[model samples]
Target: LDIAFIVEGSDNVGEENFNIVKKFLERVITGMNVGQEDIHVTVMQYSETVTLEYSFREIQSKESIIEKVRSIPYQGGKATNTGNALNYISKHTFTLVNGGRQDVPHLVYMVSSSPSTDVITRPPRSINVIPIGITPNANIQELRRISQPNNPIILHSYSTLIEEAPELVLQSCCSRKLWTEIPELCNKPMDVMFLLDGSSNIGASEFEEMKNFVRAFIESAEISNTSIHVSVLQYARENNLEISWNVPQETEKLVEMVHSIQQREQGPTRLGRAIDFVVQNAMSESHGGRPSASKVAIVIVSGRSEDTVEAAALSARMNRVSLFPIGVGNRYDEEQLRTLTGPSAANRIMKLQNFEDLSTMITLNSEFIKKVCMDPVRECIDEDGNKKKPGDKWTLPDQCHTVTCFPGDYTVLESHQINCERMPKPVCHSNLPAVKIEETCGCRWMCPC
Candidate 1:
């Protein structure tokens, strides 16, 4: 694994907090294998100016790497130039000459205490960036912009990072399997409903684009009765069941229905009524909603609704369904969208500038489903087939031999000594009388003799 740490050194992070950041990095280093063959590390410091303090080639061992980290003086500056830092790392550090091998997995971990001065253009997909925000101050929007979809890791403070560093190192450094694998929707069972807006606000062309987006999303996933059962509902002042989960349609049939779907002409946007209809009629037991399976509702809207959405949204939440409201274009009410999605709305709500950019939602929605649907892999399962959570004192897998050495005491009381006797009582003619008395006591102990 080739990994880089781009630590924040903005002036807001004073000398004390700067040392705390370094200490956190050191803790993470202690948990990495960090040798020539495993887990090479590069450390960078970024503030108003970006500095590559050390390159991957300089990384020799974990102990030496941690020592170098401790020696870095705080490069406190006025602004947080995260954009330049991200760009620099992508262009310069992650290269063949810098000990970055194309065959191995590469990762960038950025720790920032403040928002970036400039907008962050995402780095290449090959180098996965996990932005760790030191919270209460870290800008989440900027963090999310830099990280992979649904993959930002936020810590409450530098103090809490010690607890998360081991897992961080394990996930980023030890295994490439998780990062390389593209998540498949059919792997987990889910009940999904796509509630789309078909109203006067959306033109015919825009509606067609929306359908294309839906088609892409649907075609990407495997759909069946056992996994990812899907339904589509189109609405304006009234609602239409375009694809019903109650009627069993295989993945092929589902895609075909979306292909031939038509838009409703000249109807007002009544999003609230549509949501209520789904909660009452579409997601019921008769409509193929299995309580055992995860229930997800995605509302795609292009404009403000004609009626209130709170009551209907609350009903969906009360029923334990996760609602994701996507606001397309600039005209929709931001507050309504946020309310419909609930708290952490920024994380759940997909706000797009135009309908043409709906392809971005595929990765975002896929990642969201992967995260909210299933629990992470567990080590053990009970007889009832329930997986057990990690117990206390359970050490994480040291796949790269992160903790190879142990501290112990050694006894070595029998110390050796080296001595040089006074040269044979130098017989100087001028000081013969003074030298003669000194020469008589010339004998010295090499080891107490």
Candidate 2:
């Protein structure tokens, strides 16, 4: 990776604070691998003018780089021209002559205490803004505009810079993919159990579809002993453990096992018994349940349970086991599913028209399920600064965009575009005119005769 630090050297950040900034850079650089073949770093100080302290080609070893940063004198000026600094680095710093490679990823860190006096434009490379000491005067919106999306680091005072150096180093070492992708996509340990309904009410074909749904979910997840440990159980009159979490299996092998699972279409659906069995036998330490891992159960139901489920569901929740119940067909009682999910039924339960709909529903809602498994706390802060739970949907004001908060660290924003060409033209009488009215979905024509 190639990194550039654009330090603010204006009068606002006095000589004492400037020394602290240098210390911050030294600590961050020390944490990273600094060699000719590895990370290359460039340092520039900007006030009314931008001055290159060093380029990537000037320093190679970690010790030499630390010494150079310590020896460099502060360039103090009256005005903070951040735009000039960004433009200078984009033109001169990241070039072949300066030891910048085409294959290496480029990152720019802008440390500033005052807003730019000139117009700030987005640079070609990825930029992260670090605003320190002057939060009230810092142009947060403009800083965000110039930096990468959601990539601004704010510090109340320069004294806090040393404390945050470790996290800054960690962020610097991350690959470009990790920075661009959703934060929750980062792996977390989870123990997931698929509790299948294999009663007589569901046909053999429907049971196969259920298996396919489970297989699809497993295929998409990062399955390993340290990541997501999966187990499957088929329940009817009796419970059959198809796959045990205790047995360590690769993802491909697990998928094959799920494919070979035959339907146990025996007596009536006794889902309550299955729930109780999982809580007692499946989620125990002896059964391969990790104490640190989040426990999740995806229960697929075909019809109403022959036994009561409310008490069993309550027990599961009390043990910190999250239950997501997918109700298939109209035969199952909606109220029972709601009771099974307890207070958060609206978000936890999914009702499908038939077994065939499972594929489509899984494709669309897989992220939602993954979020549930990864984020045990089950809350996210949206762009509007509003607290939202998983499955909550809201429309953006004055725009045709809808935002949904999934369980993880990200929120999905969907645009509802109007297909004006598909709509037929409205007819108007000779004496009256037609008026166009704007609606959330599209435009509508109103005529008065």
Candidate 3:
């Protein structure tokens, strides 16, 4: 769930506007409903060379992160080396690490007022690039290529149309799962159990194809040692465990071995049995000291399941396993996966129309994992800077938390890099001593600044 913001512009915004934008950005980032720890931010300004205004992962302290962003002065240059900026990000920001499970999603938000330089190079698969076209000068074609959902109509006038183009900003910065719908849900770790259809409806070949899609999607992320325990249950006419969850060390082997299965278009899709088996059997049983009573997620994949799915689904629901269904092939059981995803859960379920393109489908789901699962372990310092563990509710004016500690204005500008050239020393401002404030109404109330 690491969200990186890149501000690119040939003509940098003026200091006044820049400072305003910086403060504005601070407010926006801190005010975002996502948990502070779940939201790690990095600032990069690109002109001739991509200058790391502030390094990645350095913004852990909300206050410090704000100060660094405020310190950056906008600098404008004649040429915009967007391509180079991307390359620098790939080479320096994210490097492939062995232990990293490639599950986290990394997003780049580029506020460019112009097109990328003619220079071109290959981009990393690990990074999802999103460009915010701020004006007519912004290149539309390239922006679409970099952003998700492929096609996008570039908003040409950021200065004049920000209010009109709210969706544009959101799509570029969608860094979390259950984001728009469940804005408060933090991306945290979880124990996931996969229940796959093994009926005649989806044969061995289609199942193997599904496995590859899931693997490819999970493998192309920017996370290390990501905790993902998968117990796969295959249910066609009968339900059986093709893989187990307790053995963490041999998880990869289990995933790898799935490809060896022969696709069998078995007679019936006994999806109910598979669902019941995993939720009641696998998740409820303790393995290697890990309690089966822990939070569980059941990911079901199939074209369609049994007719008696509701009976088994009720059992799964009663057992408290969060269900997510990824429908494969044209025979998507929309009703089944939809009901299982939760009537109110954010990002409930989606069906893939084609199995041959299942890899791409899984890739889309992987984005969900990356954006919504940053704080899987879920205990982190709240915005109040108290070690209140993750998921605690400590908001503004309480302590040294970013949401309250640093509240300021922010602006999105197209300007030169202020730090790139030699400049006079800027006066340092002293930090204000924090004053104790009460959460009287549990609602924002007007108070003296």
In model 3, the runs with Cα more than 4 Å from the true position are: 1-189, 217-226, 250-254, 286-289, 292-302, 364-366, 370-449
TM-score of each: 0.49, 0.44, 0.40
Model 1 pairs whose backbones collide = none
TM-score of 3: 0.40
Q: Write the per-residue lDDT of candidate 1 for residues 1-449, one digit (tens) a residue.
A: 77899998888888888898888888888877778877788999999878877788784698888888899999989988888898888788879887677788778888887988875778887887778777788875467557643245656677767776556546544643434534564566788888878887888767866775666566546666667888889999888888877766575577678868888764799988888898888888787777777777778887888899876765565455677887888888988887675553336777787775564345223554454345322223222223334331222122211111112211111112222243343444554332222222233322211
Go through the candidates in order and give each one's C-alpha lDDT: 0.69, 0.73, 0.52
lDDT (Cα, tens digit) per residue for candidate 2, span 1-449: 77788888898888998999999988888888788988888888999999888788886788888898998898889898988887887777878888887776677777887989987767774433333333546665466456533234545578867886446445534423322323334277788899989888888878877886776566556677667888999999999989988876576788779989999787999988899899888888888889988888889887889998865775575566778889988888887787666654347788887775564343323454445555543444433446777888887554676767666544565768676556765777755766677777787767865
Q: Is candidate 2 or candidate 3 better by TM-score?
A: 2
How would you encode candidate 3's per-residue C-alpha lDDT over 234-284 as one tens digit per residue? Answer: 667776666565554343455455555554555787676667767667665
> Which candidate tops lDDT?
2
Model 3 residue 100 distance off true place after TM-score fit, in angstroms: 26
Give lDDT for model 1.
0.69
Clashes of 1: 0
Among these predicted structures, which one has the highest TM-score? 1
